[model samples]
Target: MLKLLSTTLLLSSFIYANNVSEKVEDFLDDKFMENPRLKSVDVTVSDVVPLKQLAGWNAYIVDVEAYLKAQPKRLIKQRMIWFSDGRIITKELTDMQGGESLTDLVKPPFKDEYYKKENLLFGNPDAKHKVAIFSDPLCPFCKGFVPGALDYMKKDPKKFAVYYYHFPLERLHPASVHLVKAAAAAELQGDKNVIEKLYHVQINPQERDVKKILKAFNKAVGTKLTPKDLNTPAVIKQVNRDLDIANAVMVGGTPTIYLDGKVDNTKKKYLKVQ
Candidate 1:
């Protein structure tokens, strides 16, 4: 009887959370519709996880994607806080005694699969310290950070391992979609240095033409890969897998670094790895 009661409560909680997520989506849609600039809005509740309880309310970390009108290919992702007492709902929650925002305290823990051998870009796979980075080749910050991280691994190969994952901001750098795919294609062909090489290659961020993008990529990486090369099943699957991992981890932006499966917000924790 106790086990059955526990299972029933769990199901009830899940249904309630689902209802909350749907309500949040509807609220966003109605709010966005009021703006004349936005032709339409589609909001998706990606992940909802419980957070710490405050005074008399419970908090949840809600990750959402708002696809705006006229920008069908663009996604504006955001992390929001949902405070509820099973009767009232609010968006802000502050821990006065702790002196921290509730939202900042919540971070998605890394899954074991994130350390897959195939994703290792530098250093020994058995290194003592593991660094995972979700980066965009066209991102200005990633352009500087990714190479430096690679160099750090080179300096202490046994002490540090760097795993690279693609988190291209296609809305900002339209060329990155192709560039990341090209890099994946190159990796499939046994080119281990493709990630680092692509970071140094200069290309217009606004350029979206696939052929033009490949021309610059091939010239810089010394791989004469055609668009067809990037469209292969293996290459596509690899890129999609990277993207899925990024979304699962709630990677909001480029140059997101994780040290030993924990969020390294400063992105400089690898420098201290000895």
Candidate 2:
């Protein structure tokens, strides 16, 4: 608390000193990135600025309430608890920077009403249809049919929505999980065109470079993935989340399609579940 107050005072004086100088204001704005306390400070600046003058600063007020709220982490935001504080412990993803934060990436709060051009479609997020999918990338059957089921949007257009859930049968296909991760990474990259393609290409038993796999996987589905991106904490965490979701659902087989949001064990195909 003492440290925070001291730093706050220093920053305040800096801002106050620049109140009369345009050049000084520009210098501080450029130096804003160098503030070491930025990530730790729970602070906000609020003002309704005109579009034309939005870029100019020194007019906003410090939101003290917002600052007070920033002191404690949200429950969901409290994602790590390593060895009870020894290491960063995470349930959804271990290697990602904002693994939990990416919940909006895996499934957004407000989904599309019509067929989503950017996102996958199944049951109507708005209307009479609700759909679910049980899929594993290592399954040949899933690789062959799951994409077709998603393509139904071409025939039916709107009036329904779709949700995809991971179902990895570790017993039957031991390597399926990573393949699913690669696909999830692609899906996250907004290259739906190549996600399924990655699954299909990687199903083979041949071992190869992880980078090469990511590259080939991206190109096949009409997406481009850099080798650098594969190592990102976000992608790794997402892949781990897929594994967790699969374990939660206990899907025994691949391509176990569900329709209208119901998880029917006896029904495996889309229309069959319907």
lDDT of each: 0.80, 0.46
lDDT for model 1, please. Answer: 0.80
Q: What lDDT tens digits, residue by residue, belong to model 1 across residues 1-274?
A: 9999999999998898878777776776687678776655666665665764554355555555555567866775555566665567776667788766665566567776788787988788888988888999999999878887788677787898888898889899999999999999999999998988998667899998999999999989999899999899999899888887887776878899999998888888777766
How many clashes (backbone atoms < 3 Å, residues ≥3 apart in a chain or on different chains) does model 1 have?
A: 0
TM-score of every model? 0.77, 0.46
lDDT of 1 at 240: 84
TM-score of 1: 0.77
Minimal lDDT window, size 10, model 1: 52-61
Q: Extract clashing residue pairs from model 1.
A: none
All-Cα superposition RMSD per candidate: 4.4, 17.2
